[model samples]
Target: MNLTEQVLHVLDNALSLQGRTAGFTRDTPLLGALPELDSMAVLALLTGLENHFGITFSDDDLRGTVFATVGSLSALVEQGLARQDP
Candidate 1:
């Protein structure tokens, strides 16, 4: 799967959203929008992403904007994955 799909998978698994993410477009707002996206859920999502993608996130990457949407989070992870490439 691509980064976005992987992120969606991670999100679904992390939040146990039970396919609720099927309706999520790239612009789907998270953070203050989704009640499922609390701070703890964010941490779980991060862990899920890291584990599934084999990447590590720095403290600087924990900004609220990173979790702003499905697209934003996937973009962040995409950038991080790009940085890991040589």
Candidate 2:
């Protein structure tokens, strides 16, 4: 899957959305908008993203702006992947 689709998949699984993410777009709000996205869920989402993308996130990388929207989260993933490039 592409990065966005992969992100949505990780998000859906992390939050237990049960496929509700099918309707989510890049603009979809996640941090404050989704009640399911609690603090624990954020940790789960980070783990899922790290495992899925084979990238790591430092504590400094954890920021509220990264979770603001689907697009922002995907961009973070993109950045992580970019950092892995040789």
Give me the candidate number with maximum TM-score.
2
lDDT of 1: 0.88
RMSD of each: 0.9, 0.6
Separately for all candidates shown, the number of backbone clashes (residues 3 or more apart, or on different chains) is 0, 0
- TM-score quality measure for candidate 1: 0.94
Residue 42 miss distance in model 1 (angstroms): 0.9
Each candidate structure's TM-score, on Cα atoms with residue i matched to residue i, is 0.94, 0.97
Q: Candidate 2 has which clashing residue pairs, if any?
A: none
Give the TM-score (vs. native) of candidate 2: 0.97
lDDT of 2: 0.95
* Tens-digit per-residue lDDT, 1-86, candidate 2: 88899999999999999999999999999999999999999999999999999999988888899999999999999999999999
Model 1 regions lying over 4 Å from their true place:
none
Top lDDT model: 2
Candidates' C-alpha lDDT: 0.88, 0.95
